[model samples]
Target: KQKLVPRRRVLSRSADLAEDYRITSDNVLHLVLKLSDLNLITVRTTCGQEIEFLVDRYRNVISLKHHIFQEGKGFPSQRA
Candidate 1:
């Protein structure tokens, strides 16, 4: 066991480097939400009737409109 204690770890980048210093000890839950998770939001559409949609965040209203068109609730998507 003593012989192995002085040997360099295979996974380590260098022998001089000890424990992993770059990575923090903070818990994952403590960090801000993921980009994908942040995008998961609810959207309400009222074309004629009320409709709720769980969609990712869009850069603009046109993108949301495009998404609605793709859903095929009423009008068919021209672009597909």
Candidate 2:
């Protein structure tokens, strides 16, 4: 028999989009791995503009690095 590898379960948006579990701009989300119990993350977004996601085991990107908005309408483009 051939070896079997398990795939990571993706959190589908459809399943959580129902009326019972409506997703809002201020709602917080958690990504948990039921199989291995290894990956556990939490994400929170404000006004649906920016998000803050972090894993319990990692400490690399736990803060902001740049401005939330860089450009907008009638702004100059980056192309030459």
Candidate 3:
């Protein structure tokens, strides 16, 4: 599996968000979401021995912000 580190902090202008970072790995894929004034961009990639990145964008942003519901998964569990 590959790990996706959020890069939202490095974004200055909406145009700068129109880039994609590649992540090549096993059965796992990371989808990075970039928001634009009119739409959103989703960059899907995998991870390898070492992480890699590429410039890419999506067609819609609203779809990426959709609620992700996971069954049987409650809020963070309290530590004992």
Candidate 4:
């Protein structure tokens, strides 16, 4: 039997654009943010720059990382 890998659904604009990375207002990711355990995820770059994102409890760490990546924000290599 061949190995099977799950493919993540890619978000697009107007159901046509596939690989657009620009974060526009209409293409912004709308994650569920008002769950029981809402948390603010803050990412700090090497140069002391910080960015914040709101995520709920149900999302896994990988999903958070994926979100950051999907939004074209770029993830930090080292954790602080």
Candidate 5:
């Protein structure tokens, strides 16, 4: 009789590993994964114009605000 062992699956892409498992103490990997998964956010301007933006999920409020300001014309006075 022969004993058999299960083969571990290999992840071809870094993104796959990042998404599937919790990598301990890997801030760079986490950041990379977060940046890769983009979320679409819709914002209504004070002038009543609706705009959509594709942004990273892990972006902080300040970073988001800066992005909105640079790409979306102007930054809102209130928190987004």
Candidate 6:
């Protein structure tokens, strides 16, 4: 009988496996993981106020516009 091991466990123990598969790089491993959580976007208002917000990369532009509107900022209205 053969025993089976989970790929996750094997990859965790072996750096070579990860490197060969290009799962991560030495410098960017943490950064790549962090990018999944949020992306930073800087918005400059007409009043010269610079605002920074963290947004999900998967969100659509319409949703982002609504978010900015809720923050009391103006965004160009979308036409259907």
Number of the top candidate by lDDT?
Answer: 5
Q: Name the TM-score of candidate 2.
A: 0.21
lDDT of 2 at 57: 40
**Clash pairs for candidate 4:** none
Runs in model 4 deviating more than 4 A are: 1-35, 71-80
Q: lDDT for every model?
A: 0.44, 0.36, 0.34, 0.57, 0.57, 0.57
Q: Any runs in candidate 2 off by more than 4 Å, and if so which?
A: 1-20, 35-80
Candidate 5: Cα lDDT at 11: 41
Best by TM-score: 6
Per-model TM-score on C-alpha atoms: 0.27, 0.21, 0.17, 0.39, 0.42, 0.45
Cα deviation at 49, candidate 3, in Å, is: 49
Task: Point out the higher-scoring one by TM-score: 1 or 2.
Answer: 1
Pick by lDDT: 1 or 5, better one: 5
Per-residue lDDT for 1-80 in model 6, tens only?
22213333333443355545455334333211234557888877766666677899988899778777777435443444
Query: What lDDT tens digits, residue by residue, belong to model 3 across residues 1-80?
Result: 22234333333334433344332343243345655444323332232122222222442334333321121134343454
Q: Rank the candidates by TM-score, best first.
A: 6, 5, 4, 1, 2, 3
Candidate 2 lDDT, tens digit per residue, 1-80? Answer: 12221233334444443334554556555555434323344333332333333333433442222211321223444567
Stronger candidate by TM-score (2 vs 6) = 6
Backbone N/Cα/C clashes per model: 0, 0, 16, 0, 0, 0
Clashing pairs in 2: none
Q: Higher lDDT: candidate 2 or 4?
A: 4
lDDT: worst 10-residue window of model 3: 47-56
Clashes of 1: 0
Q: Candidate 6: deviation at residue 13, Å? A: 15
**Which scores greater on TM-score, model 4 or model 5?**
5
